[model samples]
Target chain A: GIQVEQSPPDLILQEGANSTLRCNFSDSVNNLQWFHQNPWGQLINLFYIPSGTKQNGRLSATTVATERYSLLYISSSQTTDSGVYFCAVDRTLYGNNRLAFGKGNQVVVIP
Target chain B: EPEVTQTPSHQVTQMGQEVILRCVPISNHLYFYWYRQILGQKVEFLVSFYNNEISEKSEIFDDQFSVERPDGSNFTLKIRSTKLEDSAMYFCASSEDGNTEAFFGQGTRLTVV
Candidate 1:
C-alpha cells in the first residue's frame, strides 16, 4: 500500500488569492489525479497528471512521478472553488485502478 | 462530457438491515469503483470491478460488502448487513480504461442507525 500525505490540512484564502496545495506519496505510481469534493459530495475531476504540468482555467496541477509528489495550484480563486481537494495515486496494476488517496486539503475561499 | 449517475441521493437503514447503492457509469467506461467518505473525513477506496469480477478491494470491503453489475447500465454496492460505521457518503466512479482518468458520481449518502 502507498501512503499519501497532504500539507496544510486546512487553508483559508480570499476570493482573489492564489494558493498551492501539495501531495506527497510514499512511492512511485502509475497514475495520479486531483479531485475537488463539492458541498454536494460530488467528486469532480480537476486534473489527471501522472507526470508533467497541466492547466485549466484557474486550476492547474503538476506531478513529478519520479519524486513521488504532486502539486495543485489555484489562481484568482473563486468562492465556488471552496471544497476538499484530494490527490489520489494508482500504485499497482490490480483492482480497476485502485487508488490510494491522501487525507486532503480543505480549502475555504472566503468572499 | 460524460458523467456517472447514482440513484437515491440519500439512504437510511437500520444497523442490521440491507441496502443497495446503485450507479450508472458512462456508457463506454470499462472500469468501475466505489469509495466512501465519512463525514468530514478522507475518501477511502472500497472496491473495484472489471471483467465481471472484483479486480481489487480494500480491507474495509469485508464479507458484509458486495458489488454487482446486474445490468448493462448499473453497478451496485450492497451491504448485506449494515453497521453504524458503514454510514458515510458512498461515491461511484468509472473510467473508460483502467489506465486513464475516472469520473465520479454525485454520491449516495448512507446513514445507518
Candidate 2:
C-alpha cells in the first residue's frame, strides 16, 4: 500500500490570492488524482495527473512521478475555492487501482 | 457528462442494525469502489469491484462488510451490523478502467446511533 501525505494541513487566503498545495507519496503510482471536497461534502475531481502538468481554469496541477510528489496551484482564488483539497493515489502493485487518500489540505478562501 | 449517482443522501440507523448503501456508477465504467471518510478524517478505501468480483479490499472492510452488484446498474455496500464508529460519509466511485480517473458520487452520510 502507498502512503499519501498532503502539506499545509490548514491554509487561509484572501480572495484573489495565489497558493500552492503539495502531496507526497511513498511509492510509485499508476493513478493519481486531485479532488476538492466542497462544503456540502461533494467530492469533485479536479485533476487526474499521474505525471506531467495540467491546467483547468484557475486550478492547475503538476506531478513528478519519479520524485513521488505532486503540486496543486490555485491562482486568483475565490471564496468558492474554500474547501478541503485531497490527493489520492493508486499504486501499481496489484493493478487493482485502489486509491489511498491523504489527510487533505483545508483551504479557507475568505472574501 | 455521465456521473455516478447514489441514493439516500443521508441515513440514520441504530447500532447493531443492518444497513445498505446503494450507488449507480457511470454506465460505461467497469470498475467500482467504495470509500469512507469519518468526520475530520481522510478518505479511506474500503473495497474495489470489477467484473462482478472484488479485486481488493482494505482491513476496514472486514466480515461485517460486503458489496454486491445486484443488477447491471446498481452497486451496493452492506454493513451487517452498524457500529457507532461506522458513522461517516460513504462515497461511491467508478472509473472506466485501471488507468483512468475515478469519478465519485456526492456521497451518503451515514449516522449510527
Which predicted model would earn the best TM-score? 2
lDDT of 2 by residue, B6-105 (tens): 9889999999999999999999999999999999999999999999999989999999999999999999999999999999999999988866889999
Clashing pairs in 2: none
Residue A48 lDDT (model 1): 90
Q: What is the lDDT of residue A65 in candidate 1?
A: 86
**DockQ scores for all predicted structures:** 0.70, 0.73
lDDT of 1 by residue, B1-113 (tens): 68999988999999999999999999999999999999998888999899888988999999999999999999999999999999999999998888788888999999999
Give the Å error, residue A41, model 2. 1.0
CA RMSD for every model?
1.1, 1.0
In the range A7-101, model 2's lDDT, one tens digit per residue, is: 99999999999999999999999889999999999999999999999999999999999999999999999999999999999886444678889
Runs of candidate 2 exceeding 4 Å displacement? none
Candidate 1: give its CA RMSD in angstroms.
1.1
> Which regions in candidate 1 have their CA more than 4 angstroms from the true location?
A93-95
